[model samples]
Target: MKPVRYTGLTIAWWLVGTPVSAIDVQHSSLVELEAAYAYKTGSWQKQEIVWRPEWVTRFDSGARLTVIGEGRFDAKDKLDPGRPDQPFRAQNTETVFPSDHIDLELREFYLDHYAGDAFVRLGKQQIVWGQADGLRVLDVINPLSYREFILPDVEHRRIPLWSALTEIPLETWTAQLVWIPDATVTESTLPGATYSLIPDPFGEGRLQVNRPDSLADSDFGLKLSTFQRGWDLSLNYLYHTIDDPLIRIDASGQQVLADYNRSHLVGGTASKPFGDLTLRSEVGLESKNRFQDSLTGEIINTEVGSYVIGLDYSGFSDWFISAQFFQTYRFTGTHDNGSSKEQVTVLIRHDAMNNALILEALGIYDLNNKDSLIQLEAEYSVSTNVVLRAGADLFFGDQSGTFGQFQEASRLSTGFTFSF
Candidate 1:
């Protein structure tokens, strides 16, 4: 791993340049300390704990600063203590233990300035665009870490980028631009051969990943948004390196090489407010995307267009339901396996006990592959600063499909959060 250069220090130094005696402070600060713990059920039980702290400062000049820090402790070991003589297999080992031991992360450190009709933010930050849930269509600025799969909050999994973002108002419309000079791409944390959609090359003792380190691999994004009546619309464009890598087998057919391809995206989004429901939709076109052949080592180049449309209704009591239809179409070459690209996602949530308890369910079903994944969760607020949560992950259907490949990875999980 290479060292990542961030601009948080420079911004913090600039903000602290004011003299102590001449300092013109405006308001007091708010500080919060938080901790969380999660554990899985069954024999190969895995557990983790995290401590996080945050501080917010407001200045008289309409400038605000926020800082957050995190530390994680994992109790799972890579190799089972009882099976000392057995060979280490990627499917049975835990990467979080040895790789992430004593991990300390500066989750967020940013400063925001507002002037007239424009705003500017500097430092390491997460910029989210798009309105859909459980899937990403137009949110292409930041890479994500899926180390713990989908059990963690999506906001926590997003990797922040060191960038400068500016929002300018032009009459009735707003334009936003972001530039990320660091070519850092965080790949999804797939647990070797156990929960991955593809077989693990490491388990077979043949794996190689190639990464781009030059300035040309950086990213740039632009978005223009406006409102009409009760509807919000936006247009987005981004030129960046794909976070997910495509695999290419070597001539020996045993060694697999991973390559991060460069691509561009253009998309549009719309959100409308109905009587008792909210509707959201996104459409995007991706160019120069590459797919590989599993057996022949040939790379297939193709263009893909995908869209998602959904609506959320909260009319009844405390129940909220959301449903989305998502599909992708290829305009170029076809790979070895002729599979369809369509999936349906649904989310349901209910608040009970005067909003202190939440019960939620989410499902993703593949229309073509006939495979599905369902997750159920329940959370209760023990107090103003404490929360308890439990969940279960279930997969069903054919072995060659997406959700079915994780059939053996289902498990019951529980966790708690404390804040003060």
Candidate 2:
């Protein structure tokens, strides 16, 4: 069998250490191992297993080096490798392989160098942005999977999973930055992984959006946060101008929209507590790209969308809750002729027996028309970092029967996750 090209890259990275000091795993050092599992349920059942081992050592000055190796496995209930003679259901004399177990994934590699409070990390990594949950208007800079975030995507959709980060701490505050010069994905990953960095459908990088050896993009971001005894506030700014997207979405429904045609982001968050209860809030915004209209013949304005105002309450030690409302208003935007959307969400969380038993509920409302979503969830901690969660999501309004983009009028799901 042909060897993996990236495995060689990992070895080369290990050989190249920093001033922090190098350790011969055969000689000196510290090492650690970690594993994680995430699963989801629904029409599609998915699961993922991540196993990694790491070695760390100090070289000289403030420099250090770390060798990280990771393996990922995915499994599904149905996957046809080939052969019409082979049934696409069972993996037997006539069964197809599930989407969950055909992976020899390498998640990370590379060395790290740090001098003073300044740090540089290179290799496969995950870049997380946005302080809000669910909707990610301004968080388009980094790659993400809603299936992984919201439900469960046993199918791994990897992105420009490598990059660098730097941080500078100051009195009472600090600054951080992320740079992803190379944003590529493994060729063997799920079909859901791809993007047109420009977020512009009719722009450059579309064809190479998900191809490897073509990760030519970067994301710049800054955040300033501090405390004032009674409350904490943070202001964030992000600018993502990509030559090609690290992550892209493919629309399969009726109103198939092109992957985001490139966009810009900006947002912030704040938190405070009253007596025994605590409160927090966040907001984000994005400016859409301008491209050819599918129907109209002119260069119409796409529009800049914004997520606004929210509140969270955690007054009781055994209970936690949050609520947020976001709407699409006009600003530095163009597509107002018919572009319209507005939503509201509410959530509640409760804990008992040291957070062993938990309950949660979330609901979404569509102000423009008749689209609303209601979800309820409950879970019991079977062990530390492991739990059984069950829930039902209900969709109401005219947009339910429409498949694709806004498919499923109502559905139910239950699953669990384990982290170790």
TM-score of each: 0.85, 0.64
RMSD of each: 5.7, 8.9
lDDT of 1 by residue, 1-420 (tens): 013223565675575445313223333222222222222224443555677777676665557777766666655532121112211111111122224334556666788876567788877788888877857778867766645555456887777766778999988899999887655555443334233333464454455656655356668889999998988999999888776778665656676666778788899899998988999999988887888766565777877788899999999999999999998877764546653388899999999999999999999999888999898989998998788888877877897877776666666777887776
For model 1 the TM-score comes to 0.85
Model 1 regions more than 4 Å off:
1-6, 14-41, 77-101, 190-198, 202-206, 251-254
Q: Which 10-residue span in candidate 1 carries the lowest summed lDDT?
A: 85-94
In candidate 2, what are the lDDT values of residues 1-420, reduced to their tens digit?
Answer: 013235334533554543224434322221222222222223443344445456555444434445544444444422212122211111110112224453333434455666566766665555555455565544444454322323322223333344566767778876667665443322221223211112344332223232222233345677676777876766667655422223332333212122223445667776677765556566666554454444543454444556655676767677777777676654533343445457777878788777788887777676766566667777888976566767665556673321112333144555665654
For model 1, state the Cα shift of residue 381 in Å: 1.1
In candidate 1 the C-alpha lDDT for residue 241 amounts to 76
Query: CA lDDT of each candidate?
Result: 0.69, 0.48
